[model samples]
Target: MNYLRGEFDLCTGCEACLLVCSNRAAGGYNPRLARLKVFRENENLINRPLVCTQCENPFCMHSCPVSAISRAEKTGVVLIDKEKCISCGSCIKACPDQMIRWDKTGKADKCDLCAGNPLCVQYCVPGALKLVKKREVPGK
Candidate 1:
């Protein structure tokens, strides 16, 4: 399995990743629509990128009343099936990281690793975001 990693020490808060991700995922350039988010701390001295880790035991998937969220067997990416979704907000409430959200269509949305080619990782010029294989991660 592979997942996105974020390093606050390397982040510049440029929001390039958000722009690119929003364009690809929501068909817009708005950062608010991006699947991931960047948070600032210490009077904006620290910028931390927050993305879906694609947990081994994803609460978002288990909380879905209609079973709209599922982890892909091949990629381990938690995906939301809009067709089956009822927009009950269960997954959103279950996510501790607040990764899941409601899209423009009022359906649940979250990162799917862009189908294994994340635009956020690509656009993160500061290298704060990375798509890392689970085995390659230290202390995993």
Candidate 2:
């Protein structure tokens, strides 16, 4: 499994990742519509990028009433099947990190690792975001 990792110390709160992600994910320029969120904490001393960990136990996947969400075995990226999805917003509420957002079609939208080639990672100039192999991450 490969996952997007972010370094808080390296983040500059510039929202470049948000911009590209929003453009790619939502086909718009709104940061509020981005699946990944950056939180400014510690009195604005640091920026923390909150991305979906693609959890070992995915709440979003479990919460889907119509079984719309599933993990890709090859990449370990959780995906939503729009054809099966009913736009119930259950997955959106089930996500603890607020990583899930609404698509233009009123369906759940989330980080799919950009199908293994993330545009957000490319736009992250501060080196805050990078894709980590499964073995590289602990407790995988």
Candidate 3:
């Protein structure tokens, strides 16, 4: 399965990823609206980027009361069906990483990997964030 990976050592805390991601996801440049988060650790020594892992057993997907959230079979990406969403915020609460959140429309929103070409990865000048594929384990 493909997922976003973050390397703290390579991160410069520039937040370029956040800017582009928010613009793509929310139609704005606000970092607060980004689907991913960068946390400063150890007195600003480390900038740890946190993005949706698109878990094999995603808590966000299971927590949706209306079944608005689902994993795309082809790409293995977790997605939200806006038409079926009820704005209940169950997914938000269920996410351990806090990747899911309320959008301007008051509905659940998360990263969709920019339709397989993540702008965050493209804009990460420090090479902190990357989209990578992992081999699925046998009989997991």
Candidate 4:
């Protein structure tokens, strides 16, 4: 399964990924609602794209009392079942990356690998975000 591996070195903090992701995920143009978030640090010297890693030991999955969150068998992508979510915020606290955010409806939201092709990667003009195979060395 491929997931977003964002390269800060190549990131320009354009926020295009955030816009597209937010639109798809939240049906609006709000970065805060986007599953992926970008943080600017050191007076914008570095742009960090924060996204779900879909860890093998995902804390979000385990923290969800209702089992609303689960990993996709075909793509290994972590997904949230909005219907089952209770807005308890346990998954939000469990996420180490802080990638998960509460939507307007109060459900936890995180990256789903766009079901296969990520809009973030497609719109990242700087090529900072990539959907790459899970590897031990990230590029090896």
Best by lDDT: 3
lDDT of candidate model 1 versus the reference: 0.88
**Candidate 1 lDDT trough over 10 residues, lowest sum:** 131-140
Q: Can you write out model 1's per-residue Cα lDDT over 59-129, one digit (the tens) per residue? A: 88888888898877777778999999999999999999899888989999999898888989888888999
List model 2 lDDT by residue over 1-140, tens digit each. 88888899999999998899898888889889887999999799989998887887789999999999988776778899989999999998988798988899888888888888888889998989999876532332
Worst 10 residues of 4 by lDDT: 131-140
User: Which parts of model 1 have CA positions greater than 4 angstroms off?
Assistant: 135-140
Error (Å) of candidate 3 at residue 79 is: 0.2
Query: By the TM-score metric, which is better: model 1 or model 4?
Result: 1
Query: How far in Å is the alpha carbon of 67 misplaced in model 2?
Result: 0.6
CA lDDT of each candidate? 0.88, 0.87, 0.89, 0.85
lDDT of 3 by residue, 1-140 (tens): 68899999999999999999899889989999999999998999898999898887888888888989887877888899999999988999999999997889898899999888899999998898999996662321
Tell me the TM-score of each prediction against the true structure.
0.94, 0.92, 0.94, 0.91
TM-score of 1: 0.94
Ranking by lDDT: 3, 1, 2, 4
- Model 2 has a clash total of 0
TM-score of 3: 0.94
- Give the local distance difference test score of model 4: 0.85
